[model samples]
Target: MHLDKTPATRGLPRERPVLLAYLRWILLVTLVAVASACALSWALHHPSFESEIRVLVEPAEPRVGAAVAPDMETERQVAISGVVTAAAAQQVGVSATYLQEHASVTVPAASTVLVIQFDDTSAASAQRYAQAIADAYVDYRKGQAATLSAASMPTAATTPNYPVNGAAGLALGLIVGVGSALLRDRSDDRLRGPRDFVERTELPILATVPVRRRRWRRASLLPVLRDPSSTAGEAYRQVSGKVERAARQRRKLTTVTLFTSPSASDGVAHVAANTAIALAQSGHRVVLVECDVRVPRLAGLFDIPSGPGVARALVGRVPLNQALQASEVENLSLLPAGSPGPLGPGELFTFGAVGRLLSAIPADIDHVVVLTPPVLDAAETAVVAEHAHLLVLVAVIGATTRRDLEGAAAELSGGPSSLFGGVLLKAGRGGRAARRSQPLPAEWDDDMGPTAPEDDGVAEETPGTTAIDRRGRA
Candidate 1:
C-alpha cells in the first residue's frame, strides 16, 4: 500500500458550503457598512427645496453677420455679479453672501437664454429668491443694450428635487459583499469540506467523527467508553472495524497499527484511545501504547500513573510486564509514556529503542495500537512508522491544511510503513450523513480466535481465526 506517485496531481474542487461560509462573513460586513452609511446619511442630511427661473436674453440690436456669439460669457458673469446679488439680497431681506451662495446662473450654449437656480429650506423662499435674482439681472442689463438685453421676464418653477435613492444604496452594498466574499474564499487555506481531503490526498476516508459539542461541564474524553450509542462512539466503532479488517488481512503473527497526524491537536490520540476500546469490546486482547513521550495524553485520559512505561522499557530500566498497566476496560491494556530520561525524547528513539519496545510486546495480544506524535513536528513518528504494520492518518475537518496532509503523506509513503488510509475527525453533521452506511464485517465475531498456546504459538484449532490473506477479503 505504498504510493510513489506525487499527490500534487490531485486537485480539490471548491465546495458550495465553504463558499456559503465565506458569504456569511461577507454579508455580515456588508450589512454593517450599509447600516452605517444609511445612519450617517440620515444624520447629516438636510432636506431643501429647489426653484428654477428661465429668462430669454438677446442683443439690443441683432447682428446679422456676427463673427462669434454675442459674448454670452460676459452676460453670464453680469447676471451673478455683486451689484445684481446685492439688489436681490436687499429685495429678499438677506445678506449678499447668502444670495450668492443660494443662487446660480447659467447661459445655454448657442442661444440667448439664461437659467437661474436657487435652493432654500422653504419652497416659497426658494421661489422668491429666484425671482428676485432674475428681476435684478434684468434691471442691470437695461443700460447695457449693446452687450445684452432681457428679452422676457423670468418665469420661476415651483417643483423641488430629491437626491437620495434607496435602490442605488442596496445595489452598492451587494456589490461590495460579493467582492469581499470572493477575496476571502481565495485567501483561506484550511480544508473546509470532505471533498478537500478526498481530492487533495486521493486517499480513501475510513471514518468521519462528528464534532462533539461540549454539552456538559465534565464530559468524558472517551466517547466509545462513556456512550457507545452516541454519534462519536459510532464513528470510532466504524474506524475500529476497518482497522481490524485490515489487520486480519495482513495475516501477521503481530499486528502493529500506528496513528499519527500532520500536526498536533488533530485528535489522533483521542481516536487511537477510542479505537482500542472498540476493538477490546469485540473480545480482542488489545494493547494501547502511548509512544508520544514528549507530550503524552493517554496516561491522563485513562487516569493511570505514567511511570515505568514505554520510556523505561525502551531504556531497559523496566521489563515489559512492569510497564504494562491495566485499564478499566475489559480485555484492554495500557502502556503510558513514562518520564523522558536524561537523553530526552529525541535521543531515546535514535538507538533503535522504539522497534525493540514494540517487538517486546506479549505474543498473545491481538492488536497493538500505538499513538505517536505528529509526523511533521516530531522525528519519533517517522521511526515508529517504519516498524508498524499499518499507518492511519488523522485530519481534523476544518483545522488540517491540504499542504500539511500532502507533506505527511509524502513522508510516510517514502518510508517503510504501509498506509492503510485516513480518518477525518471533528467532521460536522454534514460529514456524518455523507458517510456510506457499511455493515460490520461478518468475520468480526465475539469469538474471533482462541487464546494462544502457552509456548507463544497460535493455537492450531482456530484456523478460521487466523489472519485473512493480504487482499482484506474473506
Candidate 2:
C-alpha cells in the first residue's frame, strides 16, 4: 500500500523556558546555600585559643657604704597585674570561654621575655595566636629594657602575667565548610538550564511544556476539560489549539509523531499519550498510535491487554477495527503496538505492513498522535514518519542535548518530501526546555504566511482563524 502523507502545520510555543531557567537558578542557589552554611559554622565556633604574657621590670642601684657612714640602704618593688586576650579575635578565630581559661604565661629568673601559649581547636588559630604573642612580647621587652637602663638603683618588681592562645579549630572548620560546598557543587549532575541543550546538539527547541506533579494516565482524562484554569490543563488546551491552528492550513487532518531522544526520561511517552487525549477531549477526534515497537508503553498507559494491536494487524492477521481500542475520553482511541515478544516489531517497521495498517485507519479522525521510539535508537520512528502527514518530534528540555536535537532534525530533513516538524516536549517552568525556540527558516513559513507565536510563544498567531490556508504549509 502506498500512502501519501502531506505536511501539516502545528503551533509550538517559543516562550522563555521558565522551568529550565528556574532549575539553573536553583542549582546556583544550592551552591550558594551550601557555602553560606559553612560560613555560619565557622563564624559561630571558636577554633583557636590564645594567651598573653606580663613582664615586671625593676632597676637595681648600688648601695653606697663609703667613707665613714655606717649603713645606707634602699629598696624598691613594683607590682603589675593584667589579663591576656586574643588579638583581632574576629579576623582569625572565634572567641571561647574554654580557650581563655586554659591560657597561661611562664617567667624564669632574670628572664626579660615571658613566654605565653594557647591551645586552639584548629591549627590556623594556634599559629595566629603564636604570631600575636611574639609581636606583643617584643614590644613589651623594649619598653622594660629602656626604663631599667636609665635607673641608677636596683629595684624588684612582681607582675601577674596573662597568657595568649592561638585559633586553630576555627580556621580548619572554615576550610572544611567551604571545601564541602565546592565538592557538592562539582558533583551535581541534574539538568541545569537551556544552555545545556546547545552543549549536546545544535537542534532548535520547537515547543516547551512545563513540569507537572500529577501523574498522567488515559483513564482519568477530565482535568483538561474540567479545569481549564490550571496550568496543566491550560497547557493541554494550548497544545491542542496550536496543533489545530497548524493543521488549519491543510485540507487533511495532521498526523503528529512524538519521539524522545535516546536518553530522555520515560516521561516522553506519557506526554504524547496524554496530549492526544487532551486534544480528543477538546472536540477533536484523536487516535493515539503506539509506534515504539521496541519498548511499547501505550498498553501499560491505558491499562489494556496487548492483543491484536498494530503488530498483529500489520501482518494482516487482524483488522484495524479489532486492534484499535477506544479510550476513556470520547472520540479518542488507542492503537497499541502490543506486548513485548519475539515477533520483532522493530523489524516490522521496514516492512510495508506497517504503512498499510496506518493508511487503513479512517479519515474521519481529527488528529493522529503517534508515540514513536527514541530517534537515536530505532529506525521505526523514521520509518513511521515517512507515512505521517507531519512529524512532531518531542524533546525533553535538558535531557536532550543540542547535538542530538540537531542530528534528529537533520535526520528528519530528507527534504520537504519527508514529513517532519519539531515539537519540544517536557519543557517546564525552569529547566533546559525553557529557552526561546529557534526561528524556523523562511521557506518553512513561506506557504503558511504569518502565524502568531501561540500563547506559549512558539507558533506565531495568524491574524484570524480564516488566515490559515487549509492546504498545508508551503
Candidate 3:
C-alpha cells in the first residue's frame, strides 16, 4: 500500500528504448542478411577450367566434278557422340556417361566449323577432358573432309565476382530491413515521435523534460533544487510558470495543482517533486503534499523523517498544521504521506476533509501541489476534483502508451476541476514500443463508454460530460 518504496524509474532505460529500439531492429536484420550473402557467394561454386578445339569441314575436292557443301551440323554432333565419348573416356580415365555429361558441341553459323568444349570441377581435369573429347572426335571423322584447325588450350580458373555479389546482398538487405521497420512502426503503441505526441493528444504540453546526461543529475530526481540552470531544471520552472499563469487567468487567490498519471511508472513522482522545488526557487510559498498515500513517495524522495503527516492528520491524530514539514529549499514545505493505520481511500477526500486541509495551510502560501495516485487506479480523483483547481498530467514518452493516456483523460473528464495541461517526459525519443504496451481490452458491456482522447482538447461546458477538454488552454 506504500508508494515511496516503489523504484521503477522511467526517466532512463537500461538499453536502447523507444525510437532507438526500432532502429536497432532494422540494423540487426540487415546485418544478418548481408553476412549470409557473403558466405553463400564464397561457397556457391568450385574452381573450374576449360579448353576448346575447333574442327573445320570442307567438301571433298576431287571426288566429283560438281561442287558440294560440308554438313557442319553432323560434324558438331559427332564431337559428343557415343563412340567419341567412349574413346574420350578411355583417354581421360573416366566413364563414357561422365564424358558425355561434361562434353558439348556447337556449329559456328555460316561457317563449316565445329566447336567442342568440356568442364570439370578441378582445373586440370577440365582441360584434360576437353582435349581428349576433341581428339577422339577428329579421329572418328578421319574419312570426312574435317581438319583440326585450332589447337586445344587450357584457360585460367574463373573467379567469383565480388562486386556483383556485394550489390545483390545490399539490395536484399534493404528490402527486408525497410519492410521490417515499417511493420514495427505500425504495431508500436508508444508515441511515435514529437509530432506524434501533439497529434495524438492535442493537449498543450506545459513542459518537455529532456533525458539527463550526467549520472549524478540522473540520481537526483529534484534537479530544480540541485541545478536550476540545467536544462531539466529549467523545464520544471517552465511548468511552474504555466501552472501559475493558468491559475491567474482563472483569478484564483490560492491554487491547488494535482499532478497525476495514467500509470504508476510514468515519471510522475520526479516531475511532481521538481516542480514544487522550482516554484519555491522562484520565491513563491509552495507546499508540496504527497497525497498518494497508497504508494507514498515524498518521504523517501526528500530523505525526510516519515511520521505524523497526511495519514496522521486524516485520522485526527494530529493537528493539520503540525503535520506540515519544512524542506531544505526556501519558500517550500513538504507534507509527506506518513505511516498509515486502517483507513479507506475515500476518508481524506470526503466530509470536507479536502477543504479543511487546504484551509489549514498558512494564509501566505501561494500554491499547493498534491501528488496523487494514477487516475485510472485511484477512486479519489473524483473526490479531489473539488479541491484541485488545475489538473496536470505527467506522461512518459517511452513508458506510456496512447491507450492508457486516453483512458486516464476520459476518467478525469468526470471531474469538476478544469483540465489545465499535461507534462511530457523524455521528449527526445518516442513513437516506439519498448517497456510500454497497450492496455488490456475492457469487456464490451452496457456501462462501458468510449475510451479515447478528445481530438479537440476541450472539455464540454456541460456538466457530467465525459471527454478531455482544456477549453481556453488549447
Candidate 4:
C-alpha cells in the first residue's frame, strides 16, 4: 500500500463530468418545471385592462363670515362607498357586485384628491366604468356638500400592464437548476468516474473496464475464454500489458501479483481470472492461484473440482503438483483453495506458509496471479499481501467508495505489499466479456517466448522431481 506522495488534487479533470452529469439532470428538471408553469399560466391566464381617474376636491365658496373646512378623508370614503358604486353600476349597465369587485378608490396623501381605478376585459369598458364612478361620486357630493366641492374632472386612462415577465422566469429557473446540481453533488458519496478515484487516491489507473449489459444465459465467468473479440477482451489485454510493464520495471522473471479489492462483489475474481488468461494468451506461462479460502470461486470459474488445491498442499496433505490443475486455456493452470480444514484462514495463511508457497513455484512460470479475499473484510489477506511482489486493487466504478479504497490501501501498506496500480471496472455501459484477436505490441512482447506444454489433467509427484515444469508445463 504505497501511497503516492503527489499532492492529491481536490478534483481531477475526469471528475468534472460527474458535476456536469448532475447539472444536466438539474437543468432538465428545471426546464420541465418552467415549461409546465408557463403552460399553466397560458391556459389559465385572463388579460385585464385597467383605467385610472384622478379628481381634485376644493373647499366650497366660504360663507361671508362663517369658517368652512374641507375633510379629504370623508370625500375619499364617499367616492368608493356602496351608494356611489350602485349608482355608477346602474349608469354603466353592470352589476354593483361586479363594480365593487373590479373598482377601487384611494386618495393621495396630504391632498384633496380621489383616484378611481377600474379593471375590465376591454379597454373601452374600463374607461367607461371609471368615468361613471367619477360622475356618480360628484353628484352625490353636490347633494351632501356644505363646505367641500368637486373641482377638476377625471383624466383619460393610461396604458395597461402585462403581468408575466419572461426574463424573471428564466432567471428563477437558472437559480433552481444550479442549486439542485450543487446539492446533488454534495450529497452523493459514491465515486462517479475514474477521475474521482484518481484524485482521491493518487494511484495510477492500470485499466478501465466498461459496464456491460448481458443476458443471463449468455454470461460467462471467464471473459477471455468465452468471448475473445469484444471490447471487454481488449480491456483485459490492456491490463495484461500494464502488468507486464510493471514486472519489467521491477526486473523480475517470476512476478507474483495479488488481486484484491476493498470489499467483496467488486469483480476482483473476474479481473484476476481474465488477467491470467490474457497473460497466457500473450505467450507467457501463467498460474492462477485461488487464496480466497473463505469463499473459493476459481475452481467454479474454470469448471474444475475443488479438491487437491492450494489448501491441501499448504497443509502437507498433497504435493503442489497433485493440487495443480490445467485450465481450458493453453498456458494457464489453476491452483484452487481446496476444502477448508479445521483452521481458519487467519491461522492457515501464515507468513511462513505463504513464503514457502511462493518459493515453491516453478522457476519457468512467468507470472503467478493470486486471487485473495477482500482486504478490508479478511485479516488473512494482510498475510497474503506480505508475500506478494505486487498488489492490484480492483474497484467497481459506481459501487466502490472513497473510504473503501482508502481503507484497503491503508491495510495493504500496513503489511509488506506495495500498490502496483488500480483497475477500474464496470465504468459505463457497453462492456462485455470477450477476447481480442490482436497480438501484443512488439514493444510489449518482451515475455512472448515459447509457451509451456499443455497439462494432461493428471498430477504426478515423485522424490526430488518438480511438480510443475520449470518452463511452466505440467
Assess every candidate by TM-score: 0.73, 0.54, 0.76, 0.68
Winner of 2 and 4 under TM-score: 4
C-alpha lDDT (0 to 100) for residue 52 of candidate 3: 72
Q: How would you encode candidate 4's per-residue C-alpha lDDT over 263-349 as one tens digit per residue?
A: 876767778999999999999999999898777777666667776676656655667777788988988988988765666677667
**Which is the better candidate, 1 or 2, if ranked by TM-score?**
1
> How displaced is residue 27 in candidate 2, in Å?
11
Give lDDT: candidate 2, residue 267: 47
Clashes of 3: 9
Among all windows of 10 consecutive residues in model 3, the one with the lowest summed lDDT is: 459-468
Tell me how far candidate 2 lies from the true structure as C-alpha RMSD in angstroms: 15.3
The sequence of per-residue lDDT tens digits that candidate 3 reaches over residues 162-218 is 567667877888788878777876776774333445455555667777754223223
lDDT of each: 0.69, 0.49, 0.67, 0.69
Residue 135 shift from truth in candidate 2, angstroms: 24
Which segments of model 4 are wrong by more than 4 Å?
1-13, 17-19, 28-79, 88-98, 105-173, 214-221, 249-253, 431-474
lDDT of each residue in 367-391, candidate 2, tens digit only: 8777777766677766766655555
**Residue 302 lDDT, candidate 4, scale 0-100:** 66
